[model samples]
Target: MALGMNRDVFITCAVTGAGDTAGRSAKVPVTPEEIAAASIEAAEAGAAVAHIHVRDPVTKQGSRDLALYRETVRLIRASGVDVILNLTAGMGGDLTLGSVEAPLPPSAVGTDMVGATERLAHVAELLPEICTLDCGTMNFGEGDYVMTNTPAMLKAMAAQIKALGVRPEIEIFDTGHLVLAQWLEKQGLLDGPVLVQLCMGIPWGAPDDIGTLMAMVNNLPKDWIFSAFSIGRNQLPYAALAALAGGNVRVGLEDNLWLGKGVLASNGDLVAAAKTTLTSMGAKVLTAAETREKLQLKKRV
Candidate 1:
């Protein structure tokens, strides 16, 4: 691996996340149509890839419905924007334990858990160029909710995703997650030039500090292709840091909601802002075609 940085960097815009953020702002797209439209706008603004997750139209809550995923994929493709479609395989793993004392029949309503195959069902059908594989589990926030994914589950999910020919972008939330990811690589579940996304600054996860980011990056395999993002205000700064560290950048409403304090942002605004930051630092943004080539991604249909 060369220490020299590649001037061409790929930008990925995460359209909407599976969080309880829709109600926070009307700008957050709920329906498939709005999500797809936001994605197209981001692509036009400068993102080469659009990472997606669907929501139930009525409740505006995150959902793993196969039909909704299919519709979103179709709409983005039909838009003819040339952006790579990257679907979320990170849903259906929420586990909200009952009041610390009686945690057995885990809060039935909001807690959704299934086998690895079930989680990847939409990914198998849609066959997007890239799909997320969260490397480990962690206590998310102050709630009793725990994102659960055991080693067996990750291995099973990795094998299934590899079999489907979809590149798994290992989502590493902490240093230990990177250890597990490297183990997966050694087991031959993840191929060479593995793609990774360093998800930083989430509560109870990796901190958004520079030392932590560098530690995570130094541990990655030399030949791996990587990207990094931080939540909230650090989002834009991480873009420049990722470029300087020889990796890609991911931005959009998923990790942030505002372009500035009191300023609501659309997907395009985030991607365009990232582009401006990267280019100002002497880095060239990659087009969809260029990104496909750099990441060795196959075109879908």
Candidate 2:
């Protein structure tokens, strides 16, 4: 097959995720202050966007506290860092079933389902330049946990996101998620500039293979913008793969914890590594300003 490489690319650093990864790596930022600092570091390291997920400073678990989101956004803007802020609006939809036999009632320990309005409370309050929209529901990972996002829920969130004038980074974990995104576009909920994040290599979702990646890329709307990343060791490698596939790149502790063998990574280290990889491939890493212009983002401070 012929190469359709993108000469110019922008990197998005997913600083931290809504997962139980803080204890696994000391570099994972938990507090709002730390999250903000990590984002600034990524911005300095050539990442045009900082994908943020706040954690409970006390429990070190992911949180959807509006105050935490507020403080984190405030600090990032106050530092005069110019990276486009992209907050995760994918929380509050977690579902952990009781068991294989008694699945009638969800497990109270891990299940966190809420209304669409509450799920996006942080986005409605913070008004970041870009926010995530998990495009479809899927069996997220192990055991009984399922990432639940029904069509009705997605439509409601997309409509509100459009009304708020915030760009939705449509997160496609599998091929079906991409189809759902197309459906959302057809429904006029995703009318404006569309951006997608192809999340690969997660168990029960899309695998991180070249052929699978290209298939997902080929299925995307020609005019839509996209970035791609895989978790773990494949994270940095995806920088080159994404650019080669005519897309952008994403990297950070949220997706991977290591800078090298036996070397834990900070968010900055991941972004720097991705930058070096993309640049080594002769791809020009775009700055924050250029990214904003390309995506037609509305900057709010």
What's the lDDT for candidate 2? 0.92
Candidates in order, TM-scores: namely: 0.97, 0.98
Candidate 1 weakest ten by summed lDDT: 1-10
Q: For residues 63-98, write the lDDT of model 1, one tens digit per residue.
A: 999999999889989877899998999897889998
Q: Provide the lowest-lDDT 10-residue window in model 2.
A: 1-10
Q: Rate the local accuracy (lDDT) of all candidates.
A: 0.91, 0.92
The alpha-carbon root-mean-square deviation between model 1 and the true structure, to one decimal in Å, is 1.2
Error of 2 at 127 (Å): 0.7
RMSD of each: 1.2, 1.3
The most accurate candidate by lDDT is 2
Cα distance off (Å), candidate 2, residue 255: 0.7
The count of residue-pair clashes in candidate 1 stands at 0
